[model samples]
Structures are given as structure tokens and as C-alpha cells.
Target: MTHRRAREAAGDKDVLVLGVDVSRQMLGSGLLDEVHLHLMPVLLGAGAPLFAGVRAELLPLGEPVGGAATHVGCSVVFGP
Candidate 1:
């Protein structure tokens, strides 16, 4: 999914991109939310990356306040 979708999926809070390293023998995994899991297909031959350049702003989740079903978390807004 696109970053905007990811942000929307993540709710109204800001989205952060965490750094993850993967090896040819190791599996690559990503987390979008508690409901979804992000994974990439296996590549056996010499190939290029699925994504070229990605630019993102850092947004920290400051406070979380809400009920079990809904939440309003404090986040530093950063984007275009």
C-alpha cells in the first residue's frame, strides 16, 4: 500500500518508518498495524530492490488516550 494509505490505516496519528535489515537467507517482515502484516516475496537471483527512494518524516506518538475500541494518540505532525 502507499504511504498515505498506510497513514490512514494507522489512524490519524503520524506514520513512522522503522529501519529493518534483511538477508538472502532471512525472511523480511513488516508491521502495518495489529490487523495487518507486511511481507515481501522471495528473490533467488540477483535483482533490484522493490522500492527505489523513500522519504519520510519522523512523528513520535506522545500519549495514548482512548477506550479499548477507539484511541486518540498524541503524535507530532510532519508531512507535506
Candidate 2:
């Protein structure tokens, strides 16, 4: 679905999007308020690149919560 359609479909509920390309599209859509990223330590030799086509923007992050993986919270900033 397109971003506008997704936004309309979402209403007031939070939607979690998985995968790099979709995430990039969502980030560019200006419909997200915040993002939670789960960071794990592992190495896969070849894969899709994160932030491959994302524009330059600053996401203000909260202090990370650590566990088997680190959870980071960030608020999206939509303008230059």
C-alpha cells in the first residue's frame, strides 16, 4: 500500500513495519512519529543495506535499553 493509504488504514494505531526497503519508504513518508530499533550483534556477510536511500535527517534518540539486544527509541524529525 502507498503511504497515504497506510496512514489512513492505520488511523490512530501504531504500525510496525519490517524490512529495510519498506522501512526506508515509511521513513520518507513523513507519517511516523517515532521509531524503535532493536540492535543485535551479528554479522551476515551479504544483505540489503540499511539507510541505503534514506535522506539525511536527524532522529533524536532516547537512551538505549540493553538486553540480549539493545533497544533504541527515536523521535522522527520531518523537515530540513
Candidate 3:
């Protein structure tokens, strides 16, 4: 589901939805304009597939933006 549609469905101005992870069915619905991924460089033998639905290559947006999580950020194409 697109962010706008999800927001409208919930009838709330602020709605947090999960866009990543393999479980999510919607990824490249051509609804979003941009997609951000803050990932840690690690090799987990088994876990939730990263960018399972993400097809486009990620491009660095700017300098490393850090938060509670230590990760390297990249921007991926959201739509055509």
C-alpha cells in the first residue's frame, strides 16, 4: 500500500508503516518517490531478507547520517 493510501485508510495524519522486509507484499508499487535504507554491513547467515523486494540500486544521499543505529544510508528509486 502507498503511504497516502495507508494514511487515508487509517484516517490519521501520522501513520508509520513498514516498507521493507520480505514479509511486506508492497514494495515497488510505483507509489513512493524515494526509498531510504540504513543498513549495517554484516553477513547474517540467516535472517529476514534485506531488500527482498527492492530492485533498484541504492545511491548515497549525502554524508553518513547516523542515529540510534549505526548504519550506512543509501537512497533507492521508488518509482519509475
Candidate 4:
């Protein structure tokens, strides 16, 4: 089954994270209400790339929030 199709079969409300490659393939394939990401401080030399193929825009969620990067939760804006 296609990446998107498989994800759909998994049912909605399932917060799934695909690899960069799979994400790229499944990008823009389904409707996502909101995506939450925990922005953690510290960066690795190399790691999997998120949103490599995602086309949705990311907007901050909740009140005006800013931190040192220890941990930050973000919301992604879906749809045009």
C-alpha cells in the first residue's frame, strides 16, 4: 500500500512520525489537524530530517512562548 494509504488505514488520531524518506513520500497526502513537536535544545552532528518533504506551514501554538530550547512545544498549521 502507498505510504499515505497505509497511514490512513492506521486510523486518525494516531500521531505517527515517519522517516525523512517516508515523510517526503507521504507529505501532503492526508489531513492533519495539528502536529505537536517538542523542540529540544542541543543539536546532533547528523540526524533524521523532519519536514524534508512536508509542505504545511508551522505556526506556534498556545500563548507567547519562548524558551532556551530545553523544551518547546509547537503546533503545525495545516491547510492553505
Task: Say which candidate scores most in TM-score.
Answer: 2
lDDT accuracy of residue 53 in candidate 4: 57
Q: Candidate 1, clashing residue pairs?
A: none
The digit string of per-residue lDDT tens for model 1 on 1-80 reads 55658778989775655333221111122323221123345545675543233222324354334343333332222224
C-alpha RMSD values across all candidates: 12.9, 2.4, 4.6, 4.3
The CA lDDT at 34 in model 4 is 49
lDDT tens string, model 3, 1-80? 65667768878454544534522334445443334555566646665764566556667667666675555545556534
How much lDDT does each candidate structure score? 0.37, 0.73, 0.53, 0.57
Runs in model 2 deviating more than 4 A are none
- Model 2: per-residue Cα lDDT over 22-69, one tens digit each: 877777766567777888887566766756655545575868899999
lDDT for 9 in candidate 3 is: 84
Give residue 80's error in model 4 in angstroms.
Answer: 7.4
Worst 10 residues of 3 by lDDT: 17-26
> Mind sharing the TM-score for model 2?
0.71
Most lDDT-accurate candidate: 2
**In terms of TM-score, how similar is model 1 to the real structure?**
0.23
Clash totals for all candidate models: 0, 0, 0, 0
Model 1 — which ten-residue stretch has the worst lDDT? 22-31
